[model samples]
Target: MSRRRFTIRRPRGVAEYGAAALVAAAAVSLVVRLLVWVGEVLVRWWPVVAVLALLGIAVGAWRAAAAAREHTARAQRLSVLRFTLAEIDAMDDRQFEFALRDLLIRDGWSARQVGQQGDQAADVIAGHPTYGRIVVQAKHTKVAAKVGSQVMYQVKGTAGPVHRANSAVVVTNGSFTRDAREWGDRHTIGWADRERLRSWAELGVPLHQILQLPTLARRRLPGTRQPFPAPYERTAPEGRTNGVR
Candidate 1:
């Protein structure tokens, strides 16, 4: 018995296969003309066929390049989001509040951190400076932590006179309970959940500027080069205490 060997060719992509088909059809038509006179008909339409084949290849290449570019952009956005989340996780409570405050200010809202020492109900109060104020409760917590209805109630209770401020806003790093969200909806309080916070951070909004309240005094002392120090620092002068030196 004799053994026969055969080789198989792999299929080409759309552009390659289309070009091959166009070439083969032209060659076959020319061959037909040599045997008969039908080749003239094929030759007459050859320019149109070539133009159509080239147009098809160009369209396919454009679509492929567009898809590749879209995937690359999406990957880049994901990379940026990951880095932003890492930074948020690393920030201390103060820093997180500062960042949130700055974001509000950048959005054209005036903000102030209502110190816990006072009868303040919210962590920050923001407004349009001239129109009204919006109470903001900033919660810097781990992923496991959650904001409950009680926090929402407290913010609503502390939002000053209705004539001065129209609404309250609760901002948190972790998600809020369903009950909390329902409470906010019922009371007309705005909830800025973890997703919104993440979005703001991704957009590169500054949170520190929101804490710059006008009533707060700006002071600079020793060990500080800047003319004004952050308002959150201790107000007492250096080396001086309430009683002891």
Candidate 2:
């Protein structure tokens, strides 16, 4: 059997090919100019040619720099997005409310938690003395079970009597209904959906730190079941005894 030899070919990108073509064109033009000079018929356009060449180099460098900056920005945004998702996943309903309130406070708003256990409409009331009062209803539902128009109306109704605020803001871990968003728009209410929450979390905190909260709790008590002791066990601790008394 005869063995066939395979040749490897290198691939060149458009930018690489374009740069090569530019260098080749410049070399060819220089050679042509040299030939014309030898024949004593060289054009007196050296200054113009020099300026064009400089312009071409500047444009190429600028394009390369712009492309690099775009790539870097995309990578940073992706990193931020991943960090935000991790933070969201680590948070429970109460923790999420705390995080949201912290973010609002960081943004220079005076935030106060209302009735955490049984709040009718708003979970938090945040305000800037100049920007007026803003009512915040922070919901930590799964992506599928999002707050809809009913919840929005409920909040609006509850907020009307509770506080005559300037604006009502619903911040949730999931998204809002299209109708809900439209209703908010019509009623001049603000909706901070999942994307906005994620963006804020990314800006305010790191993912590693957020994830570390649960990990730290688990590490503090190795091999321990939660709810500490079941409710039944708490009521009947003696029931588990093998012998009497």
Candidate 3:
């Protein structure tokens, strides 16, 4: 049997107290030195920092004002500008896409012209609160020309999968060939040919009214191959067809 003796310790002495005081004083001195160093840095670089801050603020304000002006101008144009087939035909491909974007905007949807070198077949993308997202492929061509099935293939392949759009459409100031129309119909791809374009752009028909969409307006359109009539079956050489790709 063994009994253990326990001892209670208190602060060592003045040396220990002095050491603790020295540590506290050193920490305070270090903090004060750090603050002074930081102050000196701010003083030396204040001009450059101020210039950068002013430049950033100026740039941000300029961009905001510019965007506001552009939006106002666009809204004005949507209300006032008359879009004719002749005017559409006169436009380049890029301008044609912009026209589509404006038309979408006019119809109470947020729209943007996304056509470029690598646009992934989406010339104009739009969203509506009720009708959901739509992706369009703008094919600008002569009245005599037609948009081919290749364009439909492009839009159908990319619109739903890549762009996450609820509807995929190929729009043209020209018409779609029988093959193109048939292919589009089979794949649930919408066609906005010259007639439909006139209705949407010129006559101010809402897009949802012009196109035959699924009954479930708000649902995401399923990309499926449905049966569509292919009349007057014929094939032409890829480059020689009287259609724009």
State the lDDT of candidate 3 residue by residue for 1-245, as single tens digits: 89999985554899988888898899999999999998997899999888998999999999999979766755554464447788778777767777777676666667766678999999877777677778888889999898888888888889878888888889898998999999988888999999988877766666776885544344433462411111222222233221111
Model 1 clash pairs are: 98-207, 99-207, 101-210, 102-206, 102-207, 102-208, 102-209, 102-210, 103-206, 103-207
Q: For residues 2-121, write the lDDT of model 1, one tens digit per residue.
A: 998898575589988888889889999988778665456458888887899899999999999997975675455444332255666666666565555555554555665553655355
Tell me the tens digit of each residue's lDDT in model 2 across 1-245: 99999995543898877888898899999999989785553257766777888999999999999979756754554443333556565567766665565555545456666636668877777655445556778888887666789878977886656665556778887889899989987875677777776655554432222222122121111243431211221111222221111
lDDT scores of the candidates, listed in order = 0.60, 0.61, 0.75
Q: Clash number for every model?
A: 10, 0, 0
Clashes of 1: 10
Question: In model 1, what lDDT does residue 10 have?
Answer: 57
Candidate that beats the other on TM-score, 1 or 2, i.e. the better one = 2
Best TM-score goes to which candidate?
A: 3
Q: Specify the highest-lDDT model's number.
A: 3
TM-score of the candidate numbered 3?
A: 0.55
Which is better, 2 or 3, measured by lDDT?
Answer: 3
Deviating ranges (above 4 Å) for candidate 2: 1-83, 204-245
- Residue 75, candidate 2: how far off, in angstroms? 17
| Cα error of candidate 1 at position 10, Å | 33
Stretches off by above 4 angstroms in model 3 are: 1-81, 215-245
Mark the regions of model 1 whose C-alpha exceeds 4 Å error after superposition.
Answer: 1-83, 129-131, 162-164, 204-245
